[model samples]
Target: MSEGAKLTVQELDKRFGDGDDAVQALAGTDFSIAENEFVTLVGTSGCGKSTLLSIVAGLEEPTDGSVLVEGHEVEGPGRDRGVVFQAYTLFPWLTARQNVEFALRDEGLTKSDVRQRADQHLRMVGLERFASARPNELSGGMRQRVAIARALSYRPLILLMDEPFGALDALTRQLMQELLTGIWEQHRLTVLFVTHDVEEAIYISDRVLVMTNRPGRIKAEVPVDLSRPRSPEMLSDATFLEPKAQVLEAIREESLEALE
Candidate 1:
């Protein structure tokens, strides 16, 4: 692992079941994300991209090896790491602000302080006006905005996202990507994002790591040299195309192997 990395995965392995029925998800997966960096993981189906993110999030345990954040082993979920998934994961009964406040309940802040912080984060995501709207009353993109707001409300050291915008329509997906990138730029929070969309990965990442066929491990790392504050027009630019091509080729090779 790189010295002083904000997050590190070392020789990580994960398996399910036992004996002949066992399924191995990852093996010798090692990588590290530096402070304030945006790194994304991409791979073929069943390559354990999500599994690796879960382990980093401390939601799942690895069979061997370990995940470390700030040089400490991640034994379980902690407030220092916030997570968001594609499903929105919002409670239908609570208003958007309430959902965000829920994440801060264990922080020992007074109810009023929690409410103030929730509103602040909602405004950051352009959702302050919809603070009273529940999940069922909001659109898909709006619900995702709430999820992002909730995850960041407590100001985690690193954000882990699993295809957070995968469920949205194309236009909405693009908008969310822009919004998320803006947030990352403003906060410079370290992020570990997982996605199957090659363009999305290159567009948002400082570096993209491709995983091989399962039991998955890092096959290649493609650095994104595109200057930031990335814009929609850069999608067609040669710089973006270069890293996109690299990531695609790496994943294509793993995909072909999986089919064989």
Candidate 2:
């Protein structure tokens, strides 16, 4: 692990079942994300991309090795890391503000403080005016923004996202990409996002880590090297195209292997 790395996964491994029925999801996967760095993981389906993120989030245990955040071993899901799933998992019964406030309730803040922080984060995601809207009332993109705001409400050291915009239409997905990148830049939040979209990975990441199929392990690491706060036009630039091709090629091989 690098010095001062925000999150470190050293010699990580995970396996399920045993004997002939055994399945290995991760094999010695390792990487590190620095403070406030935005890194993404791209791979073919079933490459254990989600499994790795879940381990880091402390949602699941690693069969071996360790995941550390801020130089300490992560024991379980603590307040130090926030997670946003592809599903906009807001409580339908709770309004947007209430959902965000729920995340802050464990912060030991006064009720007023929780409400205040929730509103602040909602504004950060451009949803302050819709604070009262229920999840059903909001669009898919808006609900995802709520999820982001809720994840951020408690000021976690890092954010873990699993294809948060995968469910949106093309135009909505594009808009959310811009919205998420701008918010990440503004907040300087360290992010480890998992996606299958190669262009999306290149557009919003400082580095893109690709994994091997099944028994997943890090296979390729492509640094974006693109300037921060990227725009839609960057998609057409040669700089963007090269790294995108590199990532696509990496996954293409793994995808074929998976098919075989």
Give the candidate number with the greatest TM-score.
1
Clashing pairs in 2: none
RMSD to true structure for each model, in Å? 0.8, 1.0
lDDT of 2 by residue, 1-260 (tens): 79989999998999999999999999999899999899999898889999999999999999999999999999899999999999988899999999999888768999988988999999998999999999999999999999999998888999999999999999999999998899988879899999999889999999999999989999999988788769998898888999999999999998888778
**Cα lDDT computed for each candidate against the true fold:** 0.95, 0.93
| Candidate 1 positional error at 93, Å | 0.8
Tell how far residue 13 is off in model 2, in angstroms. 0.8
lDDT of 1 by residue, 179-217 (tens): 999999998999999999999999999999999999999
> Which ranges in model 1 have alpha carbons more than 4 Å from their true place?
none
Q: Number of the top candidate by lDDT?
A: 1
TM-score of each: 0.98, 0.98
